[model samples]
Target: MVTRQRLRRRNIGILALLLAGLVCFGVVEGVALPRQDQMEAQYNAAQNSPLTHDIARTSHYATRYMGNASKVTGLFRSLPLGPIRSFALDPDVFTVQVNLDASAPMAEIDRDRAYLYSATAAFAYIDNLEAVIFNEGSVAYRVTREGLLTWYGLDGFAALTADSAVWKTEVQDKLAEQDYARRAFQELFRESKTLSV
Candidate 1:
């Protein structure tokens, strides 16, 4: 019932589509997937390195002591806020300046989450750390060890940061919730909008 010419055209069109699909599959399998795998491998390597990213270092769990400023800097750098532009360690206070405008600009909730997680980690790992200050332009967020402890309760705080897995679940996972992060920030962090001259 079909003409020979019409049948030939349909077969050619089907072949063309098949060829295009094969090209796409080849590009993804040969190029895109391998690239993605390489990137993931690099990230995993970085994450596993203590010198680079030690925030998740389980070995530190047994000791629970970040003895010096250099070690503390490594911990802060490993945080999610990209990188620290500048860092200051004054006796017991740790302050860091970060570019809020870089890449993904942080919302208020995100800032709170970052501050809370950083503060909690700092207190947990740094033996001498009394407070952490995060500076973004004129605004600074300060979370004191005493304040955080009070917010979490002494026993609760100890339990929360006791282990890597527990810290991940209690602090990292819980911070993902905006409501909990909001309240936690309100209770733990003190915000100063204007830097005193």
Candidate 2:
């Protein structure tokens, strides 16, 4: 009777070992392996996107494109990282409320243009970050090719924190105060047709 029980116990132990091996293999092939492959494919796909290219180029342009001497100096000042405010205090992932003066004079327009560049530069400064602006509830027309191509969708106000991509609110309030979105970024990208630097 003792010998028979030993034989039975050995057989049960071998069965347990075999079952564990099959379970591990199933997890590897059915879940882990495929997930790894998918991540690699996504990385490869993202490398060549036009928006990625634009972002890279835009970053360079922001650094190089200085409108006027004073404007250039001023733009760098308002930058998210500038001497003004500690962006670190701002939500790491949040929307900004910019109030642009739509009725700005030619000088202000010039300044505004530089501000836009600085905004792009700000976006460039932060990695894995993004921003959007809305005037009275409509999207502007000055968005870059990359921005348009990569735009996912509208973000409800309640979801702002959840989105955490950082919105540049530099010109939104200014435009709303003036009640005109047409003059804000419209003439900047449309007429200037320039992406300096």
TM-scores for every candidate against the unseen true structure: 0.62, 0.31
Clashing pairs in 1: none
RMSD of each: 10.1, 15.6
CA lDDT of each prediction against the hidden true structure: 0.64, 0.37
Q: Candidate 2: RMSD over Cα atoms?
A: 15.6
Residue 80 alpha-carbon offset, candidate 1, angstroms: 1.2
Best by TM-score: 1
Q: What is the lDDT of residue 100 in candidate 1?
A: 41
Stretches of candidate 1 off by over 4 Å are: 1-55, 58-67, 92-104, 155-162, 192-197
Per-residue lDDT tens digits of candidate 1, residues 1-197? 57988999999999999999999999999999999999888876755222233355533432234446567666676665544566655552344333343444577886777778767767776655676777776567777788888766664355765666776666677765789889988877777542231
lDDT over C-alpha atoms for residue 31 of model 1: 100
